[model samples]
Target chain A: MKLNERSVAHYALSNSPADHMGFLRTWGGPGTPPTPSGTGRRCWFVLKGNLLFSFESREGRAPLGLVVLEGCTVELAEAPVPEEFAFAICFDAPGVRPHLLAADGPAAQEAWVKALSRASFGYMRLVVRELESQLHDARQSLALHRHSSWKAIPSRCKPQAPDHLSRGLENGYALSRDCSSIGLAEEGGSRPAGSGLAECELQGPTNLLLGRGQSPVSPETSCFSTLHDWYGQEILKLRQGWLQRARGSQPECEEQDRP
Target chain B: MRYNEKELQALSRQPAELAAELGMRGPKKGSVVKRRLVKLVVNFLFYFRTDEAEPVGALLLEHCRITQEEPSGFSISFIEDPERKYHFECCSEEQCQEWMGALRRASYEFMRRSLIFYRNEIQKMTGKVGMGHGSGRGWLVAWLTLCCPPHRTPWSSSAYRKRPGSS
Candidate 1:
């Protein structure tokens, strides 16, 4: 069929609400419309709630598929026969002429079918490839989160410690100061000469800090306090590291020349 | 698949009865379903950006059946692009009703993120452009209005239907 010589026919049918079984029962059936019979022409019946038919030359087939559902308007060159099935929209029309199949022969028809099938297949393959790329990107993002070093800190740090330890580190420089103080306190004191006890006020009898401390005011008392502080600082550093790594991993945009 | 008006209406009605139908009835279930729907909608917007350079904020209704352990769920996956194919799925009747509500929330967040990111980029670009006082503001405002609807004060929701007879 020549592109301009071909025409489209549209019919809007309404099915009884009482007869409605389901979408499949109403719209899905075999007797809807026959596929096109000749060369250089194509017929597409899009079974949206209403059937829309485009009888165009082969060139217009693509634009039909690309049509947006909203602001959806169809122009029919002729009226179509109403069918007995459920409510439907029918379009029988000629689309854009198939330029690729300009030479008319049995061999051309066969080649056209083959080409159409190959083109459809290629389109589907492109879709699948794009989806695979997306899935790959999602997997890579999840993997980056999984293999990160910050994942270790929570496990290495005492579980009994407050969650605030991690939060404090991210917000301020106080955590680093606390770590330095603890290191200083631990180095300043030694065990007593005769009692085999730590001579420093901050050091407990067992030489362990935090829960074991005897006096709240002792310099040794600051041991647990210092460790708590340092622990928070370490967590902050790890979080910052993750943030930096994430930022660095992002793809760099090409620089445009300034006018 | 193309859905009819009745089917669309049925889908819209589902979320309200979702908790009741699942025997998971509770007041909070409505909100939970709504929140999930919103998340799905936001995800759809991101998918939309994959193909088109200009943002065309339009909704689509394409239905698909999703099987779960307890019962088979019906969902309509909205598509913005068939190529580069970004879409949001509103699975289950409850989701259909809640999806648009969720989309609004998602759009707000997306706009916020875009504003923050663009603001930073503008600052960087300005530094490279020799740091004139007003050099970056024009571009920043232009980008912000395009990406973030909330920044466009006159065109905001409060002003949306204020024209005569709009209501």
Candidate 2:
């Protein structure tokens, strides 16, 4: 298949942080002259996510070889030379030889093997999904805890804004606790506007505030609305309990003094 | 830069996350929309001739932007050249949204950012929640070590080889 070579090469040379990097002795790989003897050539190898690129030297501007570390196995293998701390990246494809590489020490060899083994797009996605579910569970429990704690306090001592209880569930920004403040109104007013959607995109991690952004393809209901409704249910249940208590104590205060 | 095309070809044959015969057009000027079997395998979007088993071209979803086009269509352009977009026409608006969402989440960088965000959130939460709530922490940290041996995680080597999500 015709791959986007220009973009691929540009990605290789991009300023993104390298996952791992070191000089490794290579043998029987693409762009390297094969040797009958076991004396492999030494080159600088950099691991960036799933792509493994090799450079001529530490300062080499261009990459010599690119290996997409997918559908492959990284195994500790016997090197051509003795005590070389070698590992091989073996692919399942027929007629394609495993790329043999040797690290400087046992530590480096183990590190390279670990990085290369986990360097696949699927593995990364798996971890992200796992964490996503965990965060969801955490938020659920936190909301439950907040509800119970809010119940313990007397209705007379209740906070001015019952809405703060729901808004506090949000992670990235601090919602205004003062119900009558202009800040809270501005913040609440902006949420449903179409322009607010861009600020809420979870596409890039550079904007940490957008981490809790709703998935664009999800149903029209924002997570904020879902969360609001969820907490609103808790508030409703609490309100009913408080109303019964207020009615039993003093019916006169029901409308004017009830929290 | 030299890479093994055979390895990538083998990957293209693996089960896809999504597969459909969509109206596709290349970034080239005057390119016409052609019926192509597009397969999303991991982070690569491979497009094949309707009748062929092998793919004609593969676009790496990394560093690429997926934008929704008008009327049941979407275009994918790279960060390198924003104007050069590979347009795709879906049969329905729902399908277009599905394609765009999948394509948006298809990049390694996007996955990485998500992982980091979740990792940080989980870490911050574990401190507050404590004990049993942090069970996922072990798996996150041990992901590298867990995949060290031949024992594969669900999305690891064996899973890729198995090609689970063919549709």
Candidate 3:
């Protein structure tokens, strides 16, 4: 009969009497955790499905109790392998070591393997939990970005400098308006200076409100040649108005006022 | 030829080995492969470079089929060299296209969720949380480049389909 490829070893406590009892004494020992000696190795058997085992030995030591399981096929390789046994020593209470020092024989070794296999499942669960938590946090951050308000966008544009005005022109914002201030620039530098005018130019009257800057061409104007020039003049007019208002309000500004 | 329903089911059950066979490896040896399986529904294209300063590798799927289409196709491709070219084509016979579409959608959703998780992990690691520079944006960009085409082709009304000239 051909060996089934998918068939896996299912471990049971009753199958191996000596191994089961040895595990209880070694791993289930009272008041202390199991620890391997410097000369010994540690082995774990996955009991739920396949008896997949993982073994690690300390430095300068040989591997012991190494076994393979695949669907009722159990084989143990010859020991005294060139690998050392090392285990992290954890103390539970005052002077209480969690090392299994008593499980030295083959039966005890088998039990230890089974116990380690069970513990591995727990470890996998913990790792999965951590991954889930990480995923949850990421979703929250994405939500925040998606729902952020337009006012929250980094304006990069400030009223303080001409460099920002140039950058704003490149980014497609030709005009920006606030309650007391207005800004205007040419979308493309190629357009002639007097051909186009923006609505902000007519702040007092005859205002042509360009549709929200959705497209490359200004919605109110069909002549692309005159677009920039017209818009630039309107901007100059708004600046002149602000300058005139400033002069009128200043107490010491009368000497320099235009005749 | 394309995989059928039964074949896809079998493949899903063996993703770990399949992923390894396809050159995907975990960060550590003997570690369990944790990536979600993503199937390519429609023919997909991906371009990436091993490093930002390197040239790009172009991968094309001529007639790719996936298991689903809801989550989109979530996949990772590693390129050793920028100029290397790879192709994976599948037939659109029978239910192959249908399955591929479904797989593609499912993968997109999975990737969307995974990216969110990845971003959060990056923020936590950097200790400068939020959606700014410290927010795994770089990692996300890298991940997207590995998973999909880096740049979108501008719509052109050319007579023939053109492949970008090799650098």
Candidate 4:
């Protein structure tokens, strides 16, 4: 029998933003209390549905110890300009001390670069992806920008007859200049029970309101093809937002992790 | 299309291969062939015949602007030289949109970086920004302090809320 193939790997944390401990300000530098940066107090991560589950604490059932990538920057040592705090390496603290390592040497200087690069990767990618999606959506919408347009009928818009859509309802298209929209007392008839008489005129571009109760149009088909379209867009926006966040917190995968 | 070995080697990331129906030269003139794979290496986009390395044609992204060509097409134009461009028709509208959007974004980033580089070079010549001055880092630290999470409220509940852009 073949067992699942697995191997151990090490993902060296980048010295910069990837390692920036927003919480552990006291125990920083080389070795103190490890700033639980990535998911888990250690390294490996898990994903439940679309949400990435990283270092979770028993105290907070929600994902705790999560790191967010704000941006990236590089620090220079032995610069032409002098500073108060040189390289401060405080890694010897007990359990998670937050401190900054002040590096004077060239080798130590690179640690700052690593940290910046690490922290900035996810931020940059998200920014780029967001821009890409925005541009794509803008261009797509531009296509539909001609004069007047309406969405194709969705399944939710299946025609269902109500007592009030009552002018010889045979065809789905209610070409009633009389019923103008769904419920403003057509010509002489009194406004129906549920539909609050909102003046809906066919002339207005966004005139389709789901008639309260008197619409011959089913609750599905009441508000034109717009409700479904709006819902779809909301879902898409939510997914994109969640994906951008998850991408920020997902564990850093190193070269060695590849089989 | 002559292959440049040294140039290919210098690319930072492995090339991402994609398939696109390339419309012949000019504005939506003719049909596009599905046979060729488009190679995206560094900041250049070009297509090679099969496994051959040399590009049959290449488009520099520096001044290129990818625009939707009215009804059913998209084209990229070089701003400096408008005549130099490639118009392609995607299999579907979405495919066309995604490819164009990605390329446009990459081009924008390239332009931004180039501008920064040029500005830095000018500064160096003028001796405004001295080496090892640590001005960049100083500015960065200030920005970070303003941006750090401590200054902002947690965004847990509204993380997945619908944003305005999608519609």
Candidate 5:
């Protein structure tokens, strides 16, 4: 197949952050098979995303060998040489020999194995998607809290929350636009009916509250339990505000509301 | 750079993320659009003859731009040479948008950026919440620093230095 070798090489030489980098004794490259004697050339290996590039040395600009870490499994293996920390990146492809590599110590060996194993495009996507959903949940809950509080006091200092929240959403929209613009909207639309109650509660006043920071898009984590606890604290504050208001004393609600 | 083509060929044989017989055109001079089975697998976009099991070519989606062309088409061009583009024509505008979105997200760099962005936002939210409550941020930060120290390559004061540009 006609591979984009030039661009791949450029990416290897680029200054993008290397996921893992260390010296490794490599046995197989291209037509070479793993030698039974375990003797191999030690090269500086840099793992960039899913591509693993081996240089002639640490300062070598050009890579001698490139291994795309897809459709492969990393396993601990016995090195041909005794006392050497070794691992093998094995691929199930026919005629493709396993790349036997040895690290300096046990820690390095374990680290390499872990890094290589997780260095697939699919793994990264799964994590991103998880975080995306988590961020969505966070926003939904925050909107719900704001709605309840706004209803309690109809004419107070309008907390600058919808603006801030929409700023974050704007950033998110921009970031998602590069990949899939419709993805965020689709996610928002497909949310369960329970959150739709929150949506219904948020619409009236928040719809009129113009977001100031609606600049072009950007990008969150999965902290559901912690978020729930945080929102629980918010509920407490809301209850306190209601109690104070019932006593004919309007406390500075905005101070407690600022996030 | 020497890499095993057989390995990539094996990868192309794996189940695809999206596969369709689309009209493809190379960046070569006077290249005309032709029907090809384009399959996206991991970060590689492999194009093959409809009848062939093996791919005719593969494009690594890293450091590349997927720009939507007018009238149900899109083009992919690498950072190295933006002018040279591999164009694909979809059946409809919706199909073209779908292909463009898939191609844009098919890069490892995109996934990496998304990861970093999510991590940052998560940290901000967690820190805000953990102001009164203690957090595991220390461990997370330590782990992140160990795994992904920004701008720092592996070697530092090692006694090994090679001439640059040597292969």
Candidate 6:
């Protein structure tokens, strides 16, 4: 989130109802669409209710995710807007938040009831935790970017040279390898922390935001629509392979699950 | 490494659940059964089964080795105790590839140690038989070092995972 964008995000978030909402000024997620070299644009997210919206241009916009909170995911291929690239939006990351609330439509009572129910409540709480952590990470990244005063350095992450990767460690895509079983202590045991947080991406605890991934942002959505879409699905996909493995487990492991 | 209910529910879902189902190797009672589940939390890939959700079997990546088998499967075993292995089989080469990729990425730090250890082992051989360019043993050791222990254990998850709505 840039300096100005943070203010808008703060207002939007602060003004809205406290439950089921989150906003972040994003630099885009993995596989963002291509953009021109230096656009200096960013995105504003309005995660209200079940919809996660990435409103572009920040001007007036017609009905989008706000139209409906139905759970069916669709890929909008820049239908009316020629200037936009196709993007997908989903109300549920599926296995990330499972609920008995059927796909009939908005189960207002059921959703609220499920929100208080055991599994669904857990799922919603988890989503809150995820968004909170993401918000924290975004703030931390912003802090790092402003580590030095702007008068001294416009941005902590100065755009590196095009051939930075070839320069090796100076400012490039450096990789660290490991083989030890996350080397846990010999005492007691470690649990899977939890599930559905499938992205389980190996983001380094030490200055990972400085890692070679964030591209210069622009107000243009074309570069980030795909990426945000990818982040939406991939972030929830890796850890919860049930959607993938469920196809095989029915008969293969039915006996084992019976007990 | 801290995850909430949703992630916990997800972990209790498939693949990991399938692993738990498969990891149930001992004799079982119909009414009361113990299921060991796979949890990739914080820095550790833990295996636990209990009424209280604790891992009964844990394998530290620091002392482990992954051996990919013929067709479509791989086994993660303790290097210190090879007999203790967590073997997995995939329906296809693709699934096998994903599992391997996730395992390696999760245990990357440990694998780095193995890389150093194996590279040093390869270096010892190259030193003994000088890099004659055409030296078969030297070349073989180098090739094995690249493909065998760490570098080319090519398991892919982020790449293999199917994208949503791209059909």
TM-scores across all candidates? 0.16, 0.66, 0.18, 0.30, 0.65, 0.24
| Model 1 regions more than 4 Å off | A1-47, A50-69, A74-259, B1-47, B50-60, B66-97, B100-167
Candidate 1 vs candidate 6: the lDDT winner is: 6
Model 3, position A70, has a per-residue lDDT of 13
Off by over 4 Å in 6: A1-259, B1-36, B49-52, B90-92, B108-167
Off by over 4 Å in 4: A1-123, A127-259, B1-21, B24-35, B39-46, B51-60, B67-73, B89-98, B110-142, B145-167
All candidates: CA RMSD in angstroms?
Answer: 26.9, 17.7, 29.1, 23.1, 15.8, 25.1
> For this target, which candidate reaches the highest DockQ against the unseen true structure?
5
Docking class of 5: acceptable
lDDT tens per residue, model 4, B2-121 = 122233322212324244545434333464534445655334466655665555554445446788875456777755445544666666777776666556534324423322343354
Model 4, A1-259: lDDT tens digits are 1100010001111111112221111111233344323221222222111111232232322332221111112222222223311222211113322223233343434333333322222222222222222222222333334323644432222121122222211100111111211121122334321111122111111111111223211123324345346335444554444344334433322211111
Residue A247, candidate 3: C-alpha displacement in angstroms:
76
Which docking class does model 2 fall in?
Answer: acceptable
DockQ of each: 0.02, 0.27, 0.03, 0.01, 0.28, 0.02
Cα lDDT tens digits, model 6, B69-143, are 666767776543465455655667766665565555443233223233333433442333133342122232343
Whole-model lDDT, model 6: 0.30
* lDDT (tens digit, per residue) of candidate 5 on B18-112: 78999999999999999999998878999999988888999999899999887889999989899999999999987886677667667777666
Q: Which pairs of residues have clashing backbones in candidate 2? A: none
Error of 3 at A58 (Å): 17
Once superposed on the true structure, which residue ranges of model 3 sit more than 4 Å away at CA?
Answer: A1-6, A9-119, A149-259, B1-167
Candidates 1 and 6 compared: the better one by TM-score is 6
Q: In candidate 6, what are the lDDT values of residues A51-103, reduced to their tens digit?
A: 23444544424212221122222222221222223232222334432211111
